[model samples]
Target: MHRFLLKLSSCSLRNSKFQRLILPSLNLFASGSPPPPSANPYSADSFRKSRAFSSKSRALGVRCISSEAGREAIEYDVVIIGAGPAGLSAAIRLKQLCQEKNTDLSVCVVEKGAEVGGHIVSGNVFEPLALDELLPHWRQEQAPIEVAASSDKFWFLTKDRAIPLPSPFDNKGNYVISLSQLVRWLGGKAEELGIEIYPGFSASEVLYDASDKVVGIATKEMGISKDGSKKETFQPGVDIKGRVTLFAEGCRGSLSEKIIKKYKLREEVNAQHQTYALGIKEVWEIDESKHNPGEVVHTLGWPLDPKTYGGSFLYHMNDRQVALGLVVALNYKNPFLNPYEEFQKLKHHPAIKSILEGGTVLQYGARTLNEGGFQV
Candidate 1:
């Protein structure tokens, strides 16, 4: 799914047919600026009215102050939410087009994390094809992509033994990587291409004009108490106006989910229901003698019953570090089943315990993911 998003975003800028298919849904304007009110759904008067007198603004006690008295507004040709691979790729592609055409295009990316890669977590056995297309010289740029996968191992685990299976995992040319590190590297490249990135700013609301066309986003206000009172340090969120707004909030992102429902994005997909999975992952530093830097392992049929649709992955990465994780389908029938506890049980299996008995855990995290590939 990550690869697919990256591929589409990297090529979406100059592809007119693709733009015609997707840009209208995203409310994007052409030629790096919005069209006049006569040709566009948005009007200057309606934009101001929506901002100053919308129901939400009224509920929040936002006054109809003059432009000079309201929160500061920054305008851009494009505004991207989330600094993940997809968003950064789109921003970089737009800037590249600007350089090639000798035209100016303003681009802005907002990330909720304190830093570019702080919120990213994945078991990333990475396929480098997308990266190769996005930046062919990434190898020369010193990207943190090391530890090429050397082999694949798949097993069917019993309580006491691991029976080797005909390995379906074919990671011969992939890499076991820290996805956060790679995303940070991409963020640096985006900045080098003159893209403006604002980390630590969470996009709280999707801004729309009177005609219901998306115009931009509003950042979350700070210094608001849990009881809904403004603190002494209260400050209103800034309004980021853009000709086009891209939401790359990743799997099940809050705003993305809202947008999807609002637009019935999945209604046309033959009524295919979205499925989710809970992924629990851990990184460990193991003894040098026991470490195999490029070995990849995947297992099935233990800890989770046959009825549950789930699996586990263990990848040997660089620096004597091993990344392991368990994915459990959210549709499990057992109401009392805990995914984290199940992961703990998985590590105790004979096949997994041998490698981890003497290791030290470095990091642990869990996140929900889109289960059945990239849908809608």
Candidate 2:
């Protein structure tokens, strides 16, 4: 089943007919009962109108606003904002279509990060379904996707005891991968496809004409002072105009936030509510005796109250390395609770302590994740 899906997914990528592709999602439901009832369909429509009025009322807060002279404008067939998985994949597929159809098209991807993967962090164990569809021969091309999952360990922890539990999670064809490395690899592929990418250029405002229709974006000006004064070396931003502007700026992009409010895009039931999870992770080089490459461990129910939803993952990577992370609901109670401290508590459990005792910390980082569901 895994290989069959991979082959079919690769064919989809090769075709590059994005408009014809049906984006599939997998949703799971509990076994016992059907859902009670869904809210009225137009409930979203009414909610949106109220929210838009409220959003428009709060226009007093503004920071670092600027209208500098000498802005240079560039034209492209397509302007992609962001260099992450979605944006890069879009750029690749667009170029692929141009070549396949024998048409001339100019494409550029504007990235905010100093480099391709400079700001990317993710839980490394990944399903390569999309990767297979985007880069069919990624493995043959020496992409960084290696270290197939070998084992799974699920635990339910208490204050002092660690109990094993049966979990529904499956890892048959998944692999452990560094998202940063994966993104860098994708960036390389994009550059090879002749997609011009400008790093360190943050898209500040969505450019619009008198009609209020988005045409492109303007990059943020550089060399600004702390008091909003232009530095001696201030340079104006670029106005990259395109027929279509695609915003793939992950969860927390400024332009995305503005557009969401301006267009009232999240008025629907599922889209209106969002819950964030704060995950703090560290890579440690454990003793070789404790290293079990491709081993994934997940635990829940301890170091946190039942009301405070949380979990932890310990993925054993290659080279005696273990990536440990703890995720806690951003809406957690206990106002004084510290996210990093909670993760530290997660490590003190006997099950996790054993593997990390003699380990040396390699890297540490934290990121906020949008754990919100989407509805049609």
Candidate 3:
């Protein structure tokens, strides 16, 4: 009876044009009770009938079927490998392509982090080109950006004093944002368009076809039970086959590195062609009297030798919290040059101290930034 049920399920799944294609040898199992009618596109009766038809077709040795229009429906159009900015952007682009072509192009996004904001830490300043183009009314909606920077300052600092300089670039159109908030918003937009986002699942391996074409991924399940024990299980990762796969795992992308090495991509590119910086940042609450709501300050030099490339920034974000941080290039020879120490010394600078007087640090963290820009 179990074998017969399995065969019926396979047949029904295969005959339903709305259902995605599955490999003939693949086994299907439900993790929990069947989903509700509203959750699935097909009704239970329709699914059962399709299953019966699929079983009959398979018995007759027919592996493929033609629609009334004599065209074969595709299972998926694209499968993005990561859920970071690049992967999300690619998914959005594929949706646009499907809309333009008036076809069903399924796009799936696979993220290893438990949440969209996991692994993302930064004093992120975005150009707003993509966001503005994609969502024109973002500003009017009062998005949770830290501040729309109106000024940029460069300070060469000593322990107690500093020299401030004007930024070489204009700050007219740029903005500083909470990276977590931005990612959450972007994820929401992707989901609204029917993009499948699988978070908290890490891709264990890449799937390739017999001809060596990249197909999908195998993701490991991750979660903890109510008693705090880890759950052990695995699921078929995002396998939207036939479409382009984008690798956007942020900095130090391990999987992306493997793929680059395997494909021997860009052999001419120097391994040290790029530079990395470790940035330590914190949010502090300042006395309302000392708070400057829209103020932004940047400091460079001193504590850091002139040869070393690094800087510090302090932005008075909304809600009386000040974002203070320092970034130090990793290429420096002195391993003793601690980023946290530099940040502390920077706070003591007379100019900075006056601004942050009596402020209390609330949150502290560190992250890596790609200083080599997009080309690297």
Candidate 4:
């Protein structure tokens, strides 16, 4: 009877919804999603009741106004630091939240770069899930994705040859993009939503009120480029206060670290993980005979013989250009393993050489990647 009952339970578990719920939990543990929150039914109830009460109070004609004037330092409803993906996403959410509450919540975004894309660097293959959900009709509006990747090639290489390895998700691959273009587009969308984005302004310090809550930010004066040269004039610090300050500075975020330490936000940065890699890249005008219009080739091994954690990519973008690059982790024991040499050696490979044979390198640059993969 017990065996029969077990079989019946197994059969019931085969239902689609049951599998959907169970599969994600199993995968979450397998993929390192955080454990469920501790039970706090009373606190949860109180939180919901408080929000409802706030909504009721808001409807009772409670107006939220800054205590100071426009010329004077005024506090915003929301202030976000760093204009990266994380910061922009937070701003969008805050806008939505304010809209739902029928409140005129002022938002200010502080960016340090000359423009939004100056500090951004990536060999980015983006899955447009977030973009599609956030900005519907993105494609119809001519989104900045360089190439919609339909194929992904993972090649394991020897000194002279390469062998393709079957990928786990060969059926679905991500789209490739020039990260700078995408960032500029995202900044435009944020601005369209009435989110005041101040580029070329560096956030130097955070301001806290008497209760030790983050109330505002102190921005450092920035040098703006004039007709042909940089101007060395100092602009006075502008203080923009807010109810909440969200720091979305990307990897090795200085301000984020400072705030975390000052507030003791979590016991010693719970996201204590590190993975660093130096990416050396060059854009080349592809030789017509060798160019496969929309191909993206990725390879591992070869140039990095002893190192098991390095890879190379050659992506064909629009405008007859190809982005060729190699990323190698700095954890290798060899103190003198040159990434530039590795990149040059990769170009000499028979498979890689034939493709880039007559191509002329247009630009050369390098940047660091935070490969800690969502630890924050």
Candidate 5:
């Protein structure tokens, strides 16, 4: 029954040392191979020409070869910070443009997770409009987009009763999906398009040019002891420089946060601080007879008070599986409020209990969501 929306704000970073440079539109897809600094529009020369950059004495060059710290380096036309949905999609689209124009554009995606989707946690009721635009033949390609959403129900719960309400969620053509599985599939597609995906390699720092523009990122150094001494397996992080760098690391990503702070991205007029919510989710294998694929039930006004902004979701997925979760606003006044305990209590309610009575817990995880409405 909750509305899902993405709000993007335009911002500029103008200071005595840093010039006002507009964030390049995501819609702009460059073609051809990586070019020299003077030939590249995203380079320092062009930044100065556009009056978007000021000189600095960092002594960092355009090309990222081996560093003084003995870290190896690689160059690409585009470098993506995350291998999640946004990062993979961007890499795929860039490669698609390369194919269409018969050009060679090297793209790289760095993921901190052990695998492509290992860290992704979601109560995903997926709408495929973007997928349709990116890959029109996704269904034909046997993508894991099974279990079309068929029914939606909303409930107002009390201590002992479950009252039906007019459902605000209409997921007629959407799909109940495991977001992690889908992300892995998207990773495969990205690889097929020749996008280099480096899993298990966390980006530790954003590499910048002498003009303070982001050139790429440096991966985290591995095999360090607690005392900060190098172990036998010590391997220096690699420097990945690119003509254009994209930070697709979801909301509140480490590197992304650094960039936001460095550029003062949220200093725009009348900006509101970003709010958050903790989403605790679990996948259960329910009894075959009790399973109903594509049945989505949302509940409100039971575990949480009327003043609190939060709800619960129970999505019936394929293979007699059910995915349920509780979202609790992090800004709650009560210091004693425990989201995990609240979720356990939510499962005991008559409405939710009946469905999950004979179910076995398969997997569970928790993650944070951006809840600052129309301010992100």
Candidate 6:
């Protein structure tokens, strides 16, 4: 049963600047708050630190201040990191729990982006398995998904020839979607349920109690200069304390990475060395006749050498829009070869070129893909 969200996170140790740097555009769009003493059930032993981070504290100097001036704490029922699919889903589920049990629980979700869904993006041929459970009325509400997958075409390209790949490229029960839009819609639903969502606030530090159990996280201070000097409008981060804290941050999340080490989240596993990849994508307004809404095309073997693993995807959506992207894995051996450069070269291939011969480019971007297959 579509349970990918049930098991996520735990990425590979090897990541790049594109994946690790703290930036809004870098995160995959994604969504909570706190409760009382009786709700606090976790113990310190639950989150044992590995001495990798001394004193059970993260080196991250980020701290949270109270809603008042005397360094008070803003308590909540739960705290969620990231506004991506997993995080948002968790928030919605918690609200559902509250509704079913007829209780009022404070849930807060902190996102580093300026707005909900602003940071999230994906190639996103979305399968609505989880969404069906989270928001069954999505169809009645008109979520921003319009193009259902109509047909799937796979091609293997040689120097100048285009060869069709075999079966398994199916288009049933999936839709090409703007993941950003989907998150926005989910954010709206969360707000409707009285969930507190604070965008533009990044959880820079994990907060631990006397026994070192993670209680919550600290939001980053604003108005700090690049040189570490406090700007005139300096504002210390607010410490959002909660009974439980969930980190659904995207791949290579610095905070998640730290928590994993502090608690040895992956110590027992003989896995997690990930193969990274760079994805470059663009949205175009293709010719009316060529725009077959729901038609999806994928290509392999031409833009990249056989030794290097990479491929391309093109999905036709509503309004004559076509979203296309290229992925180049990081294990490739050539230092001189650039993923973006290769993606640009891929567009010249006859197979891909014909589709965009007369199309007008509307938008495009690059993102890092951390394919650290999920762990149970």
- Which of the two candidates, 4 or 5, achieves a greater TM-score against the reference? 5
TM-score of each: 0.82, 0.80, 0.72, 0.72, 0.82, 0.81
Worst 10 residues of 2 by lDDT: 3-12
Tens-digit lDDT track of model 1 for 91-188? 88888777899876667788887667777777778888888887889989778788899989999988999999898767778887887777777877
lDDT of 5 by residue, 204-249 (tens): 8999988999988887776789999988756667777888999988
The TM-score that candidate 5 achieves is 0.82
lDDT (tens digit, per residue) of candidate 6 on 1-376: 1232211111111223212122222322221012233321121110111111122122222223344434335666788898777787888888898899887666778788766766765667778777888788899987876788888888888867789877466659888877766777777677667565666677888888889999888777666899999877566666777888989887678899898889777766745666677778888888898889998788888779889988888888888888878888888898888888887887788777888989998777776778565554
Q: Compute the lDDT of residue 81 as modeled in candidate 3.
A: 71
* Per-candidate RMSD, Å: 11.2, 16.4, 13.0, 16.9, 12.1, 11.1
Please, what are the lDDT tens digits per residue for candidate 4 over residues 76-189? 567888877777767876776677888766676777865665566655566667776667778886667647666767898888999899754331445666765666666666
lDDT of 2 at 231: 77
Q: Order the candidate numbers by lDDT, best to worst.
A: 1, 5, 2, 6, 4, 3
Model 5: lDDT equals 0.72
Cα displacement (angstroms), candidate 2, residue 180, comes to: 0.7
Give the better candidate number (1 or 2) by lDDT: 1
What local distance difference test score does each model get? 0.73, 0.68, 0.58, 0.62, 0.72, 0.68
Question: What TM-score does structure 1 among the candidates reach?
Answer: 0.82
Q: In candidate 5, residue 8 scores what lDDT?
A: 12
Model 2 bad stretches (over 4 Å): 1-69, 268-270
lDDT by residue (102-213, candidate 3, tens digit) is 8655565767765665555665555777766656777775455546766677777876677767777565666656665566656666765666565655765665677876
lDDT of 4 at 365: 73
lDDT of 1: 0.73
Q: Tell me how many clashing residue pairs each candidate has.
A: 0, 0, 4, 0, 0, 22
State the weakest 10-residue window (summed lDDT) of model 5: 51-60
Error of 2 at 334 (Å): 1.9
